[model samples]
Target: MKAVLKRCLLGLATFSLVAAASGAGAADPFPQKPITLIVPWAAGGSTDILARVLSEHLTRSLGQPVIVDNKPGASGNIGSAMVARARPDGYTLLVGSMSTHAMNPALMPNMPFRGVEDFTPLGLLAYVTNTMVVNPSVPAHNVKELIAYARANPGKLAYASAGPGSTNHLSAVLFEKMAGVQMLHVPYKGGAPAVVDTVAGQTQLLFSAGTQTLPHVRANKLRLLAVTEAKRSPLLPNVPTVAETVPGYELSVWYGAFGPVGMPPALVTRLNLEINRIMSLPDVKEKMNAIGVETATSTPQQFAAILHRDADRYGKLIRDLGIKGE
Candidate 1:
């Protein structure tokens, strides 16, 4: 009887130890599997390229493969909505842009998710250098000349945008309002298509990212007038800025990472730290510079502030311009 009683106690003790050990082992690290970074744009565009580059670096740093899933549509709404609705487990993330996060909520009346409220802001990744370029046949060499011609042509000249409410569209709209010109607006499904059309003369002008336009410019297919940043890009130092020609006109296109709202604060901190570290690397900077993007990094708080400020600023702009989503 004593031996039987002792065996029963030992079995209970063994069971408890095994349970505790199992629980401890189950408390694995944050990223136990691969991560998916959603790029809310078509593959082969500037956003896609940047996301791919960042994913490669992240895979190396995070010990798991970071895959880019392209979900391009509705000027980035489709993919963004997916991220907004994803589980806040940090595995499903977004590589978003200023257009998707800041401008779309204001432009689209029926957005599926609230831009600021539905996502956890990670950090700013980089700024895409936008440039004003025209088909060589348009015969404009600089921003001033282009504006003068646009003013003269009125509704005759046409400019292509990635889509309605894209930064490309807003940039041109701001240019028109500031310069007092009225060129026609053409919307395309994506930046690559828009730039291709511009190069093929389907559109007369394009305010596009340097990644899509630089190759054409180098090939003498599209003529670069001025960069859209407040200052000249080191990539094209000799080229002036649109702000240089039109004072107080600045539109910056930025990219950042995001996860669904309610993501663990610890996870967000980990991602921000890792991403900032990646951005600070020399090779990352060089690669970004080569693609006409300047790498940038910020704390999660700072990135949240940027989203709020830009949403307010661009919301007013969209309302005043009467822009709508398609």
Candidate 2:
């Protein structure tokens, strides 16, 4: 009887140790491991650039490595779907843009995930200064001149876009529709390559964010005609808006942080606060602004609201314009 009791006590002690370890792990703070920040685009582009910058700050602030993972394909649906399917443990996050979240669902057929339902919007990161630019060799000074030139050239003027349903493509299409001109559409795999072709004069015009086009503009390789925002950007108040020349044409692109749906509310708030703080840093804002990116900060709710509104707006636009994926 005594021997049997001894064995029982020994087993009890072992079980207690295992239970204690399990409890400790469960009680540990959030982000006990490195976090993944998926960019959903190729490196060296605006979204990738912004993700890397935010990841550096996040790594320092979160006490864990916020690694950036780029999964570029199908107009950003690949990386975004990966994040949507990820566990909502705060370790996996996404730096999603308006194109991926607001526009792609409407633009792409066989979409992998619903942008609004599959994820939790964490915070607004920045607003890209969407611009319409022409290769320096193009005979156009401003929006009016560019419109006139495009009208005169018609199908002779080729405009490079990131892809068939990319924001750049949509912007250029809207420009053609509103201005009553027909420019040949040259779709590239991504914005960087499209901008490259435009700068090389292979394509005479490009509708892309300022981050990619403005540097070339400054170098005289490209000429900035106007922004795509509803109003002028504070960063470049002198630059006219496309609406001024082509009435009712506006496309505002923004980026936001997101995690898989069903993330803990506490974790969502914590991350939202961190992102807001990071974007509000003086140097971060200044650096982004230099390239025509305006850093924006907001609550998770506000981000979600913006996401819903843009999704609806762009969805209608795509349908009305009969945009299709490649």
Candidate 3:
């Protein structure tokens, strides 16, 4: 009996030692190597710019280099899927947007990864308002005028979008449905061409990010109509929100970071903390403001909730509108 008791005690001590050693190893300072952040969009787009800014800050905070890889295609599906399928280690990250993380899953028929289930939410990086702008030659000066002109012209009035199933396209479609107008949609390879065409008078209107359109607006190439948000954009203080004229109209695009599902909770927490801290820095805030992106920092739980809510919203809209994938 004495020998058996001694053996049992020895086993328990050995098990405890092993557990302690494992815990220590697990908690060792993470991000010992460089991290790769994937931006599922073309270079120079809002998502890419925001990802680059974040990569710079994270490099400083984590004491390791951070690289941005732009993999733009399928309205942000290809790159997003890559991240969704990557290993759950903290090294691989995704810079997700409304199109990649929320709307595409709702609109596309064969989305490989579940927006809410296939990844771990890190935190919101930034949010920006989409602006409604018209070519200088257009007669419309505001939302009301634009609506009237579109109704009068019907199919004659055409608008441009970044691509089919893009947020830019969805925003204009929702406006048409709600405002009871039937303007034409012309999809371009991306926003740069669409905005250029709008400025060149090839297209009449567009709903695009403030950062991208602000320069053209300032150049007097396009006239401001109304922002696609509940509140007026800070960059364009004098401009009114579309809701101000077409009641209840609200839309905005936000960016965030995520990792493959089942990432260690401790790792998630550490990442969320570091990124959120960087987002709130004064320099970061100033740079984002100069580019028309509003700072939005949140806990991982809060970001996850936002993803769920936005996914449901876009899913219903896509179903009702019968939007299909390209």
Candidate 4:
């Protein structure tokens, strides 16, 4: 009887130890499975391409596949809302943009998600170069010339944008307000479509990302007027900045990564470090530069500050301009 009791006691102890070990293992490190990177824009656009490139590098770095899932609509609100509502686990992430994080909230009346509060900013990915381009048929060689012509023609000239609340839209609005000109505003469903229509001469002007417009410029389908950055782009040294002609006209779009709110701080730190490292790579910089994208990396705190600042800046601008979402 004493030997049987001893064996039972030992078995019970062994079971407890095994259970505790299992529990510890269950709380394993992040990215135990594939990660979903939500790109809140249509495929083949700048955001989608950037997300895909980063996802490829992230997969190699983290030892798990990082898939880019496009859920584009409502000027990036549909997909952004999905990310905002996703579980706080590191498995779900966002390839967010200024349009979704800053511009949309200010322009859209019924935003589905609270842009800043619903997500944890992991890091800033890049600052995309925006250029003002016109169809080859337009009689404008530079920014000053374009403004002169627009002023001469008034509402006869029309400009294309990604949508109502997009950076493209706001950039054009700012241009109008500063230049003291009024041209027709044509908003499309996405940047790709807007670029397509502008290339087809359905619209006369476009202020769009370099990745989307550079190829058209090179192909001679569109003519580059002025870049919207404060300074001339290294990729286009001869092309002057809009600020050169219109003193304070500067608008640049940026991209960043985000995780759902309540993500583990350690996980956020890990992602920010890895992404910054990836963005700093020589090969990565070369690739991004080729498409007219400047690699920009920032800490989580810095990124959050940028969001807050832009939100205030753009929100007031949107209200002041009476801009409404589509």
- How many residue pairs clash per model? 0, 0, 0, 0
Tens digits of per-residue lDDT for model 1 on 1-326? Answer: 99999999999999999999999877778788999999987798767877898899899888999999999877788999999999999999999988888999999888898989999999999998889999999978898898889878889899999788878899999999998899999998767799999999999999988988999999999998998888887778999999998998888889999999999898999999999998889998897898788888999999999999889988999999899877
For model 3, state the Cα shift of residue 165 in Å.
Answer: 1.3
lDDT of 4 by residue, 223-264 (tens): 999999888887789999999989988787889999899998
Give me the runs in candidate 4 sitting further than 4 Å from their true place.
1-23, 136-139, 189-193, 196-202
Candidate 2 lDDT, tens digit per residue, 1-326? 99999999999999999999999998798789999999888898767878988999999998999999989987789999999999999988999988888888998888999989999999999998888899889889998998788778779999999888888998888788778998899998877899999999999988888877888888989998899999999898999999998888888899999999999999999999999999999999988887778999999999999999899987887999898877
Residue 136 lDDT, candidate 2, scale 0-100:
84
In terms of lDDT, model 3 sits at: 0.88
Best by TM-score: 3
Model 2 — which ten-residue stretch has the worst lDDT?
41-50
- Using all chains and alpha carbons, the TM-scores for the candidates as numbered come to 0.86, 0.85, 0.89, 0.86
What local distance difference test score does each model get?
Answer: 0.90, 0.90, 0.88, 0.89
- The C-alpha stretches of model 3 lying farther than 4 A from their native spots are 1-20
Evaluated against the true structure, the overall lDDT of model 2 is 0.90
Give the runs in model 1 whose Cα sits over 4 Å from its true position.
Answer: 1-27, 137-139, 200-202
Whose TM-score is higher: candidate 2's or candidate 4's? 4
> What is the overall TM-score of model 4 with all chains considered together?
0.86
